[model samples]
Target: MQSSIIIADDHPLILKGLNDFLLEKKYNVLASAVNGKDALELIETHKPEIAILDIQMPYYTGLEIAEKCKALNYQTKIVLITFEKDEAIYKQAKSLGVYGYVLKEFALTEIEQCIDTVSKDIPYFSPELLSYLEVESTPKELETLTPTEKEVLKHIAQNKTAKEIGDLMFISNRTVEKHKSHIIKKLNLAPIQNSLLIWAKENQTLLE
Candidate 1:
């Protein structure tokens, strides 16, 4: 049986393109909305098997809509469409019980796979994000962290700059930087790509 799905996006091209693409993929495209309000309404009304919502939408963001659905105990699976691959966003999506996290650029390449996975009540994240789960996300790597490094990691996840962390920790900015470097080394994250921050954002719940 074809999967019944609803999609929403502010961009006209994206809304139509996704509609056509899902139809071509043999999904039952129940409705497509150009704005967020309609998206939520359609989902509430139709209760399709899945709802694919763009992250940045007018009135209510996709995340907000997902939250509402969770509160209402709606059974429709949610797929968050986003250009941002931030780990913090992923964390929030996970908390919201989001089923799929597909980057806009990879929609054509990954959406079908994402929906297929979510259709079975499994969660799916963007392709590029899979590496983080293995890199610094291993339980052994996390276990190697000391108390001070863990504090710094929490600050990084909270979006605090090094200077801010230094002020809070009563340390010099240079010392903070050293600690950050150590944290990255221990986590096996890259030094240049802000990978530490990414890991922090994506794994906030773990730190808590």
Candidate 2:
């Protein structure tokens, strides 16, 4: 059976491209919208079997739209397509009950596979993201972190810079750097700053 779908994106080219791509794949495009608000209205009216959403949109975010869909009990499976592959975004998408996530840089074949997989009530994620998840799921020792180290991690997740974290925690810049190094070693995470930030954000909910 052909899956009925609605796509929501702010870009005209993307909206049209997606519609064309899905049409070629034999899926029915019930509607397309430029923002989350319109997407919600279309879903409520049309109730397509799936919704393909872009994360960064004006007015309301894709996550916000997904929440609304779930609340209304719309039955449409949501697939979030975005450029961001950050762990925090992935975690949020999971929490929102998204059926699939396709990175924008991946081939159209990947997107098609995701749509087909999710239409069958299964979840899908890009292979690169799957690898990241495998690394993140490994057990780590919390006892290795001092209280100050954990505090620094929490502040980092809240989008604080190293200097900001030092000021807020009433520690010296050197102390903050030492704590960050300890955190990286304990977590077995990559040495990059962005990777650390993503890890911190992804794990923040659990820390709370």
Candidate 3:
């Protein structure tokens, strides 16, 4: 049986493009909407097998609608399309159990696969999205370090000894050791011998 699909996007061009593409591929596109409210209404009325929604829409965002569907125990699987590469948004989508997440840039190229994967009761995410998240996540985790800790990490990345780092930074060796301990804790290192050093070396490029 052909899966029933409902698509929603605020931009007319995107909505039409996606709808037309699905139609061209011989998929059953049940309905299309221009806003989140209308989209939600269609879902309630039609209860499609899959819903492809733009993340940002009037009245309610895609994430919100997905949450509502989950709350109401709908059988519809949601696939969110967005331009956002934000960590928080992606995390929220995963938490809501959204079936698919496709970036706007890759929507046309990836949507077919996304729908296919979701119809099989599997989750799909843009490959670029995962790479972007990995790159963005490092900077955020690095942000948790204090300025002093960052500098200590940089020195460690350079293979500086505690005494050498202390001399260069004009702090006492004891103080440098204290900073290293704090850095290890902040970075969640295993506290095994040379674990901090290994992490520092592996992430040296990011440290710079």
lDDT of 3 by residue, 1-208 (tens): 7889999999999899988999999999999999999999999999999999999999989999999999999999999999999899998998898989999999989998898878877678897897777665674457899888889999999989999999999999999999989888877655568978977876777877
Q: Give Cα-based local distance difference scores for all models.
A: 0.86, 0.81, 0.90
Q: Evaluated with TM-score, which candidate comes out highest?
A: 3
The residue ranges of model 1 lying beyond 4 angstroms of the native Cα positions read 132-208
Misplaced by over 4 Å in model 2 are 133-208
Displacement of residue 150 (Cα, Å) in model 1 is: 20
> Which candidate do you rate higher for TM-score, 1 or 2?
1
| Sliding window of 10 residues with minimal summed lDDT for model 3 | 132-141
Clashing pairs in 2: none
Worst 10 residues of 2 by lDDT: 134-143
Point out where model 3 deviates above 4 Å.
Answer: 138-208
Write the candidate numbers in order of decreasing lDDT.
Answer: 3, 1, 2
Local error of candidate 3 at residue 10 (angstroms): 0.6
